[model samples]
Target: MNKSKSLTIINLAEKAKFYTSLCLGTVAFVSVFAFLFLIPFVVDPAITSLMADYDTVPVTCIATNHIYTEGISNCSWSSCKEGCTKEATRCHQIYVNYSKIPFREFKYQSHVSWDVVETRFLINPEGCGYPPSVNCSHFAKQYGYTTAGTPFPCYYSRVYPEMVVARYSWDDTLRHLVLSLAIPNLLFVASVGVLSYWYCPGCGRTCQKYMHHFPAEEDEYEENTYYNSQSFTKIHG
Candidate 1:
């Protein structure tokens, strides 16, 4: 009786463990998709909107000098070790001289990097490219200020006087939104579909049974055709 009871307990435990796998798999797939892919998309746009506080500084203000700078932007050391690349990061800032304002000088430095002066300004708070790599010479020609004496517009935040940028990067926000929706939903579906195949006993059994029957069914059909052909030959011969 005791031996039989122990066997029953073992069988019950195994069934419980197997039944729990589906629940675990559901949670794992949902959490991984939500945290890794979705949250960043939500957080980034909110932050970008806040950075969009800056507005264009008047074009009437003359830019006395335009400075173009270059620097090496590096991936993490681990990323580099894993064969990632380093790209050059370039920044352009124009020194704006306000002829009609309290602040005699203002710097139009529309970059993602942090600058700590009140007179500094940007066109959009989000600044330049994903990494802001616009060539200084190209920027000069495009903005109609080749050497920086010509007036160019940059933006500044009313609330945060020091906060400035060239343009709000709504494109990055849109890209993130699309990727978050597309990639996560696809990944979640695939992950859950694969996990269900293993976690659900009935699904596994159905697939396995079908696979097992396929070869036998094919062979049986072939055999029947061969036997019928042989019989016809015997009769007609």
Candidate 2:
């Protein structure tokens, strides 16, 4: 090829290689990050929500226990005489349960047990007739409750301890697995494959045409022609 044409082809090949390398590198970095970080955060929540919609299994409570906190009072003797008595009490109820269908069975027959607990807090404000001398104001402050005015009667209750299972049908599980794990990897591999096809030396058309011309054969032919020309010049001189 002529010098200018060869130089142009060489520049085009170099630009192609640079862009292909950049594209492959970006794909690799993003794939790694998505697998390690982004995928887990997204897939876990989606899986959990999906399971909640279709895979909740109920089990009976095998054992139960109730723990009560000491009653607290906020009324002084004078206030108590004026029927301004207030008290706060808290109870924690704990339960032990076993899965109905063996939620998770191990080969060794040993597995971790799960427990559930419920907490309830009650506030009672009555006159001096009440027995316990609990300091309701102190209880409210200690338990992070509001005590703006006279502590009115109130109660709070909540249940605890939840379990999530991957209990979808075979088809659903397969679909989620493919979406979460296979798709990203396949996309990355496809991108690398395309880049390799476009920029690989000796194989890709761009690289073969520009970056890897058969210069060794051309050099050998030129050397032979120069030798033949010199011999002719000597003979004529």
Candidate 3:
């Protein structure tokens, strides 16, 4: 009976260790993929925002008009069987025009047009997405555009007078920045745990082999009670 009990204890210990190690391995694997895919949204923008290089000065701006982008042209019946859901991209140029400060429009919302397209597609360095998923027909439906001739508050970079922003986003910049740094570090730690768990099987596994000898609190208490009763009977007899 005692021999069988000892074998059961060892088996339990082995299984426990195996599951623990497996969980660590899984976390490490997931962390790696998460960090890689999140780089564009988190890391890139964070680095630029953290630098504090660009200080925006307040400026009054107006949405003069809208010009469509060629992204919709690339869509065809074969390619866009779903009816060309590509959001209309536009020339969001914000610069000084005719003695007035013209700022780039933010998100492309309503005000649809197939003509008046941008001939030269300019890139925004601080923008998110790798291939740019922001401009889409679905995306436009969700967001809204300010009406033309409406005066709104805008910001312009002090150094770059030509550059203009619809609004400033310190909150997103800071949040994404933290997540960008935190996720990679978390991945690194999880990886180290996975490595250490598998690397020293002989060393750690040996200790784990004996872990089942330590009974659960309830079991230990029950056993102790039984042993004390037996000892008391012997003494009383």
Candidate 4:
């Protein structure tokens, strides 16, 4: 009875392993096909977008220059007024704001990094002189002028800020998708692995039963041979 139960368990485990492997193969095949089919629509566009769009805006600024001197002070109030006139203006004031467009902003400097200053500025990597330079107070001061604070402003749409968009990255997107799928695949594979491993114990018991029967069968055969030999000798005598 014990042997029979062992044999039954072994058979069951073997069958379970076989079935589990079949199911895993089938599912893996289906997943591959689905991945291929859905990639053009679901993954391709996301990949293209993540890298292309960053915070950017268009603005116009007018250039101007202003000078003051003691000699010019004696020119008269009318002359001072004339100095402030349109023809004497160094530049015109204009509407220059990035808050109206989509952009991503970061702190100009951080406490962790001592090499920089904290400020707001537009990130324009392709701007004329320098790559990834901001038109912040520091940069402005180099030109012999200064703005009190908030050199770079977020582009405002209505009363709110716009969201910055960028090109999609396959690594980022696929990494997330893999993470979401990993745990479930692990659980299922582990379950199947356990079932597959279970086959040996029952097979061991069945083998033990067959081993025990072999010795008994050998003993019976020996006894029958001795009897037959004795009977043959008696008949010959």
Best-fitting candidate, scored by lDDT: 1
Error of 3 at 235 (Å): 67
Please give each candidate's TM-score: 0.37, 0.31, 0.52, 0.29
Better of 3 and 4 by TM-score: 3
Give per-residue CA lDDT, model 1, range 9-40, as digits (tens): 99998888667666656766786758564454
Candidate 3 C-alpha lDDT tens digits along 176-237:
77877797768779766666857766868777767755666669999999999999999998
RMSD of each: 16.5, 19.6, 14.3, 22.2
- Clash count, predicted structure 1: 10
lDDT of 2 at 107: 26
Give, for candidate 2, the lowest lDDT window spanning 10 residues.
151-160
How would you encode candidate 2's per-residue C-alpha lDDT over 14-61 as one tens digit per residue?
Answer: 988788788777986688677666354446544544543433432222
| Candidate 2 wrongly placed segments (more than 4 Å) | 54-183, 195-237
Model 2 RMSD in angstroms: 19.6
lDDT of each: 0.50, 0.43, 0.49, 0.40
TM-score of 1: 0.37
Candidate with the greatest TM-score versus the true structure: 3
The ten-residue window of minimal lDDT in model 3 covers 75-84
